[model samples]
Target: MSSRESILPTEADFADFRKQCLSSDNWANKYDKHGRQVWVEVHPGKKKNQVPKVHKIKCKMVIDDVPAATMYDVLHDSIFRKTWDSAMNESFDIAKLSNNADVGYYSWRCPPPIKNRDVVTLRSWQVKDDEYIIINFSVKHPKHPPNKLNVRAISLLTGYYIKPTGANSCVFIYLSQADPMGSLPKWVINKASQVLAPRVMSRVHSAGRSYSEWKQQNNPEYKPWLYPEQSKLPMMNPAELSIQKADELEQVDETFKVDAQECEDSS
Candidate 1:
């Protein structure tokens, strides 16, 4: 822990995190469907010089009887995460950078012929004005290098914004921008943003509500502490995962930028 504690994230990290949190709130209010407040949008990210071959996923949801804290716990609880997030092949903390910061490893299972992708990230969170913010960006860790088993990806931007609206109710916005290394067909990215994001978010909301009960029954002793672990994630090839309609597939127009602020103009 001391070795991990020695290194620290810069002020730039916190600055970006705050900007994202505020942006989330702004977007949540900006995007509406038929006068409805909750909105979700998934689009192909602009091929910025910074991050190429990326997708931008965003969502807003209000869960009944679930507080912001509960949602945070359900997500950060590493042991519980394994049960819900279908894409997560393996996830565990690598080190404690500080009380509010850490290094974590996350691997996702990809449809075959395409190797699974993983990343090592420095994560941090904060609670202010009853709004919770979680942010993580990829980093290079000495002990955790690119493994032979998985393609290493870079998480350019990944975060969650949870703001309380009422008792036991909160607004959630999730955003992700990542480059999953290897040649992932544009159709795969398109379908992921168009199809999978909504479906996965629905699962998250359901799981967030059921998590506490599931925890009590299963891993009651589970400590959500930030301790390090080297997980050897078994690669289980599920049958249903595949890219459909290769002939009809088309690439996202990389020249077009999908800015959140500009999303209101999207039909």
Candidate 2:
């Protein structure tokens, strides 16, 4: 059966379904987790001519050996991000650094057949100490309207707190609070969080573990206090990478060419 012929609900029917789904008392329950509960609290503020939604998300992870300061470096390193962050498809160096902290920009392209659209974000990272770091990110979506969506700026605040658990092990706590734009039904957003949050968090934790292992294997004398220069790595230029397959095909020759003498001999 054709995909278009498959079971499909009309706009009104889907709207009714979403309305029923969002009305549930557990609509807010989508933010909860087991052992680690991250709450999403929507603020009661709105512009006179616009609808605004403010929410927060908090979660935690644990890492071994690597201190929070070094982790901050790892987080800012656009090249290292692909290792764990599935949401971010491409990143580039926007500017060179003068100190431990650097300003950089990243572009996110969701994994596809979804027709992944790109969103640009500016990030700032600051290390409080060997045990704490803070990251502030702002996502820019030119396609989104500024008035109706509270997440127009896509401002995200994240903090990482590291503490020693053992001689070679440490506990990593991650907290993120952000507003994602779109006129999506609250229930649909909640449902997506229920299904994908755990998997995403697991990926992040695994990323930390992998980085810790890499640090041990390579920098046995690794000092948690030092800001590593591991950020320098070749990244795809977005302009060149953004070309569509059709454009690439246009550059190729269509005619098939073969040596006439060789063809005749073979025949």
Candidate 3:
């Protein structure tokens, strides 16, 4: 084997990587920091000799709400997760329930544009009447394996911390760790996380805010259906048919007018 020197990623490189990861822009070059080696790999794919690995992502938010139980309920409740958690598109019913707390087996489907589907079995434990909650989840990739292009593991663990900030306020913290699986390159993992993690976290925060507002307005006691409605997102309007047709007609008229002018000039 030929001897080779490792390349380190510079600040500029990291900045450029961040920009690309966040916006899907192009990067001129890629480098590795710790390995201290430079390779000519210039795409989003797995690395050589890199096995599927797990990574942890943590997020925290402060919401205006009291009653630790309510905060925990909003965050840990399976029905509520469908509303706020960006990773979860839709949820299924839990067949088995433990008597001690709200424990059951649930599965989730990934959002659009991704071909893979994930099925998760999770359980939640409420600590001291919702003061805090311990959530454990394991993910299984039914479609892909560790060696595939989209290598994903079959297990993950997530925890939630909810504490009362004031009489009418609370703070929420979430931590998730999972293996991406396969031989994914480190740069790809970092890039994907750097880009998507923050956005997803932001969505979760926004969802929390919306949920809190809805709860305050409709107080579950007065309206039991409030939760369901809060979870349902409003559909976007379709493209305006009349406007498109009008634009097409304008284009046709302009073309004919130009042709007539050309003919008159020629004559």
Candidate 4:
């Protein structure tokens, strides 16, 4: 893989991906609950010994009484994430690549016997007319390599699209095309298709509800994403990053017996 600044996600890349997220032609509706709907587009891996299937998931919900800007802040507030993102094991900013983009490290828990997962991603954001978008895709960062504790996952494309409906409400959309680098069991796949999106959206909505108050008590005026001049993260050279491919990482077995209790708890 070429280690060049050009490898990072760009304005055109974000624009094209945003179009895909907004489009509905190829997406197959999968799950819907509590006003949230999820659609999945399954793409079989091109070659052998790669991930068998890559899932492009799109989920959306109308969040009432929450402004699009507030929901945007919720996604960027790492400190606030720690409190509500129970599945998260560890996360932090690695370096700033630009005013609208950065490289970061994130790891989260998987149900027992599935092992944990981690990723280094190049994240970017933009505010279009009536919309707020934040996106991230996996990247290999030299300073942070894969560890034995968590399987390195590949996030092909993942982000949020928030469009204001009114002053106090917005339509929240989450889109992701990711490969969890492991031998996924049939049951795991089934559970993911059925509940992952709704569960996550619920958590996000819950977080958004309380974020304004949380921000006030915390660093009320500190928003590095909106005002990059305030960021304390060291600037980074994009030449150090490359695409993180699933075949380059060690594959772990995510197939194990999970009881009803464990399944319920994970969701």
Model 1 pairs in collision: none
Question: Each candidate's root-mean-square deviation in Å?
Answer: 10.6, 18.0, 20.3, 3.3
Q: What are the per-residue Cα lDDT tens digits for candidate 1 across 31-93?
A: 344212333332335355553345455656666678877787776787777777777777877
Highest TM-score model number: 4
- Tens-digit lDDT track for model 2 on 147-222? 3111122434444445556555555544444333333343443344434545665665556556756656655454
- In model 4, pairs of residues that clash are none
Query: Order the candidates by TM-score, highest first — what do you get?
Result: 4, 1, 2, 3
> On residues 53-105, what C-alpha lDDT tens digit does candidate 3 reach at each position?
43444444556634545656565445556655645434553322232222223
Tell me the spans in candidate 3 whose CA falls farther than 4 Å from its real position: 1-52, 64-68, 83-87, 100-114, 139-153, 212-267
Model 1 clashing-pair count: 0
TM-score of each: 0.67, 0.51, 0.47, 0.89
Give Cα distance to truth, residue 134, candidate 3, Å: 2.6
lDDT of each: 0.58, 0.39, 0.38, 0.80
- For residue 46, model 3's alpha carbon misses the true position, in angstroms, by 24
User: What does candidate 1 score on TM?
Assistant: 0.67
lDDT measured at residue 168 in model 3 versus the true structure, 0 to 100: 65
